[model samples]
Target: MVKPVIAERGGAAAGDDARNGERAASVRWALAGLSLCVLLPSLGISVANVALPTLADAFGAPFQDVQWIVLSYLLAITSLIVGAGRLGDLAGRRRLLLGGIALFTLASALCGAAPTLWLLVAARAAQGVGAAVMMALAMALVAGTVPASRVGGAMGLLGTMSAVGTALGPSLGGGLIAGFGWRAIFLAGLPLGLLAFALARRHLPADRREDRDGTTGGTADGTARGRAGFDGLGTLLLALTLAAYALAMTMGRGAFGPLTLALLLAAACGAGLFLRVEANAASPLIRPAMLRDPALGRGLAANALVSTVMMATLVVGPFHLSHALGLDTGPAGLALSAGPLAAALAGVPAGRLTDRFGARRMTVAGLAGMAAGTVLLSGLPAALGAALGVAGYLAPLVVVTIGYALFQTANNTAVMTGVRPDQRGLTSGLLNLARNLGLVTGASAMGAVFAAAAGDVATAGAEAVASGTRATFAVAAGLIAAALAVTVAGRRARPGQTADGA
Candidate 1:
């Protein structure tokens, strides 16, 4: 009798181990699906950056007209992401994600086949719509898909994949265009999008039914004084506000004019209207009170500030490399790649560190690291730059990128960890929106500063270029410092999260 009982117990243990292995495998597959969803859109963003010139030639259009292809995509994503997140929360993340993947794939096909520049721009905008859904929902779904203890690791993994997509896009697009033409760059996404859809359908957790109160399976609240409807009026107001701000920043490149003033005024008015509408709406797109929450609110502000500094590097690095260092296009491009490469390599490890250490500690560490790097960049003597050459610039840049990877992972983990299930999608959207806005703001604002300081880049000397670089990074350092302050204030306000977001 004793021997029989021992045998039964051993058999049960073996069975349990097998089940655990299967469960782990399932989680990995699920994460892979989410990763692809993220990677495709990131690739879309950077890949097109490399193809702008090719597109200009192919469409026989001026650079200004061809640029709308990229602008439209970005504008669409920025304007629609919050609404998409809200929609996902109401409909169900899994179903909406699948639909998003399908739409992205279809849009890619349309983009590849477009015969006119305007048509291509239209398709890209549609693609951005899909991207908005994927981006917002990916992080929103993390809690549902992964164990709480490993949320940081999962977030890190997503960040790593995103960095990889960004790092790969330019080189990948270049290679494809060399052999297959510009259309191939867009078309390349079709297979990956399809795979993402299939894996999402197969691996993502099934959505459960939600009560009418908008405490739902996906993310974000859609309750309107106890009923359910999309907040179209609210979305429109917010979109118009964001669009106006974006156009204000982007149009006329580094030069500001009357139109910019008009747009800024329009955005201000639109923002006021949006807030007023949300106050009385039965179903406001985002609850005004949500912004009052320190975690979500402060986290967003910090993300945007950090993102602004990062974009400054991208906008300024090439000019510095070419003008100050006298590097050719080939070497400059290679040097530019270093930042994203560092980010890609560091992302997962940074996320893992956030998991190992507390998010607060890691966040402080990351911000501090970025601060130090930017200070170094701003103050490095011209003699030292001449003495050290590329190493001088690249060394500081690598530190900044690594720090950015760490801070981004920690900040995102911190924000999403404490969010209500009913608010995840919208919160994620807000974070993304903040980041996009920061990037847009940095591109235009920072570019303007550089231009102003250099005084006609075409005629500026190496010393002027170096001065511009220094000044840009000096401002960037201040932005990071502000971000640090935001993070610290939030930490002080709310001492702990449900878990140590590692």
Candidate 2:
């Protein structure tokens, strides 16, 4: 009787295992859906870039000020990622991600309806906040749910989504603006956002790792475990400090007078306050120890410098294509699409290469490719044939994006490997912050150059914008060449020594 009962139990257990296996297979698709939800908002910002000139003409704002429609979103999104990531660790990632989609959708409506530039800017900032929350929390959720072996592939997929979204933005915006106007471009994500929110609520398991057995909300089964609580004060300080610092940089050449000085001081005070709070708190926004690694230091610098070059390209590319070549916004936008297209396609192969070869070789090769591409871009004659110029420009753009993809993927893999798994959220936030800050700095610096040169040119305004665009590219080329040294330093300082081994 006992043997028959035992055999029956074993049979039931096998059936249960088969069912669970089927469920696991389905989970992968659901995970991909959630990742796309996190992706679409940030992607929306870049997609609208092609419509900027139209937005400016419609609103009667200067081109420089109009550009902030994009810059403001990038600044807000990047700056808040750390705080958002910390919040995800404390609260639940799924809850935060769902909330982000809701907020992002609402903000998109506001942006679409904004009657003035000020309103549009405010809406864009709100959109950034939503994007930051989605980004940080989505990654946190992925880390919690996915098995270790597949995380790299999933991360690669996420990178591909990001690249695709960015690459597709201009064409999407161009089509929308040409058909219904720029407002349609802002409003395009409404249906998609709603769909994401619904899918997330239905599919994602709650990220609570708290023990069912009576234990404190601490590490259990070797997983990071924390209660749901937010450091509102720390969040505020960080936001203020970054916002103020960005404002000062964006204003350029003391354009904003005493306000810039006040902002700088406020930013400093905010930084000091954040350090105090973080040092004393039970749970901090970012761990100080994470930033102390020598490897991290080099990685951060290289990441920032590379991003700066990217932002410079974004700022200058359209003007060169439109004003210099006398192309319409559609053709110009298409020309600018090559880099991100190459980047998206390169991610999977880059990951495999990193695994096989290690980050050091890949980093050096990437930087060398970028430098070569930049040099090629800088040498084109002012009156070069349109076909030659377009081809030449795309060559560097593709090389640089591929190089960037390789470096970025390898660097992130290295950072994640070097840090404790419990602290991955913080590590990601810090890396993102460094890169975003670089973007802001690059945009502001290049914008200043463009503005100054525009005023100096005795030719037509279009010609002036063109000149500024080419000059900015030259400057970016020089900056990228300088960053190669930082890459070398990173190679030397890395630990554990896998592509995934930082």
Whose lDDT is greatest here? 1
True-structure lDDT of candidate 1: 0.87
Candidate 2, 1-502: lDDT as tens digits: 8999999999999999999897676567557666676468557667767678898899998988898897788777766888876665555566777888898889999999999998998899898888887776665555555665455455556667778888877677778888998899879878878877887777677655551111246532365545435667787788878888887776653254787788788888989989999776655565565566777777778878888888877877876767666779778867887878888998767766755666567667777878877676666665562556567567777887888887776666666556554455556667777777787788777767766765544354655665666677678788777778876755554454543352
Number of the top-ranking candidate, with TM-score as the measure: 1
Model 1 / residue 230 / CA error / Å:
2.2
Q: All candidates' TM-scores?
A: 0.95, 0.79
Query: Which residue runs of candidate 2 sit more than 4 Å off their true CA positions?
Result: 1-24, 48-72, 110-123, 181-183, 202-205, 208-229, 253-262, 322-330, 355-361, 379-387, 448-478, 481-483, 492-502
Candidate 1, residue 300: how far the Cα is off, in Å: 0.5
lDDT of each: 0.87, 0.72
**Cα lDDT tens digits for candidate 1, 225-308:** 455578999999999899889888878465778899899999999999999999888778987778778778888998999988
* Colliding pairs, model 1: 89-219, 220-422, 224-282, 354-502, 355-502
Residue clash pairs of candidate 2 = 47-169, 498-501
Q: What RMSD does each model have against the real structure?
A: 2.7, 5.3
Candidate 2: deviation at residue 315, Å? 2.5
